[model samples]
Target: MGRRAIVLLVALILAGLAAWAVWNFLDGVRSEAEAEQVQVTVYRAAEPIAEGAEGGILLSGQELIVESTEEQVDLPDDAITTQEELNSVLTGRVAAGPISANAILTRSQWTEVTIDVTPLAELIPSGKQAITIGMDNIGGVNGFVEAGDRVNLIVTLDIAADVIPADFPTLPDQETGGEGATGEAETITVTYTRYVLQGLPVLAVGRNVRLDEDAPTVIDVEPDPTTDPGIEGEPTEEETGNETVFTLEVTPEEAERLAFAFENGSMWMTLVPEDFVEVETSGVIIDTLFGGNLLDDIFQN
Candidate 1:
């Protein structure tokens, strides 16, 4: 071939090699893009999950859903991506806080199970004081009183003549057999039962407490029926413990009254409804109790 023709041929060969190289680079780029677009299986919450709820229960109940989604380029490093990882890491853990529905599961969302005991100070509302009272099963509503419940406190006390005012009028001494006879005053004792505190919020039951007004009480657990007395009418000491402590949220003045009643008078707790309305009570004494129509109404009914 001539020199000019050979130079042209060599130029064509070099151009072809450059084109092949560009094609190979483009194909590699396309492959990498496709790989990055592959779908990945991830876990997400199907329903709202309460804080401290078990992950396994959530998954089994379909509260947590598994979905296949395109791998996100900007996905978080701690995001849960695979079934194996979720089962190993999150199934045994609990949500660190309330998880909204459809939230992507992540390592930071869960934590190891821990006792959820709320501090007593945290439970007391602003401007309220926490006071605890110890009572038997009957007084504690057969161990049914739970934290976050509302209750009324009834106190029974004995009033003696010494506690009565000294200025009160006195009748003539009958034993002296004289009219308007001035002598030592006669002593008398009377028992009265009246409601001391109404609509008091319970702060804690024993050691278990509720975190917030909306949160479920941590100590509200159903008693096991198998352990309850089947044939015996009355529960034994082993079945119902001697005392259950009830922590109540009260004002400073109410706390003082409760302390006095707890110290000197018999106090009983009566669970009140959420919409309970306070009513003026006349209080019960021997005369009022016996003279009222309560007995007649009961027998008539």
Candidate 2:
């Protein structure tokens, strides 16, 4: 019980205090690690959900499977965290697009199903009439053109001199000295291509029609396998040989021009962007094509 004894006791007390502090620090670290590893229940698709499928179908058909994932996982902010949340969000909603199996269900993946069925005629503007044109894949922008796209039409016509009426006044042939020109002129065919229409709004593409501009186009449901057994497999867009049809909204005068082009000339559609600018284009014939300085400009660049 002297000075040395007192100093030894003080040292032991300090050592015990340091041990307690170290133990507490380690315990807090362990708790934090456990908290970070905590799991939360989430909903995932058990099978493929077709676009436009209702949210109620997920619960009734048991298409959603509950999965326990760490809260720290990269889940979407609107991720369905509980069965109650899923039911609340999906009651009358439909999938925005095709949801693959095991995809985490999120609020952004579904949207309110539009109940009002808009008629096709109602979609066209008052001043516009819908005109449909059919073409091969190559001429139809390789079948990549959609209903809401804007397109420009280029028409190629091969005009033969014989097709002109006999009574039509004719320029005297300089080579034939104007005498032989009185009879039917020698048959000559000239091919020319011109941009006939620009910035035409496409109303529909093939069988897929856009009823509402804001809403997603309703996709046709797949034929039930039980009813038709002849279908081998769904053909990709590239594999199908069917002709692509584009329905455009145009004025009555424009429709007549389009009909003339469709009947007597080959037409090709060029896809244009929403902010497309119409530029003045001179019709192209063989003489103008070869006479232009386009080759010089290309090489100079």
Identify the candidate with maximal TM-score: 2
**What digit string (tens of lDDT, one per residue) describes model 1 on residues 30-105?**
9999877756667777767667666666555533465657477656678889878888776777768777878788
What is candidate 1's TM-score against the reference?
0.48
Model 2 residue 291 CA deviation in Å: 4.8
Q: State residue 301's C-alpha deviation in candidate 2, in Å.
A: 23
Hey, what RMSD does candidate 2 come out at?
Answer: 14.9
lDDT of 2 by residue, 1-301 (tens): 9999999999999999999999999999999888777577788877677777777656655335556564646777788888788888888777788888888889999888654566778889998999999888889888778888899999999987765557455766788767432444357898989999999999888766765857666644442222222434666453464438889999999999999999999999899988999988899887678667666756888
**lDDT of candidates 1 onward, in order:** 0.76, 0.78
After superposing candidate 2, which stretches have Cα over 4 Å from the reference? 1-116, 161-187, 214-231, 236-243, 291-301
Q: Each model's TM-score, in the order given?
A: 0.48, 0.49
Q: How many pairs of residues collide in model 2?
A: 0
For candidate 1, the per-residue lDDT at 129 reads 93
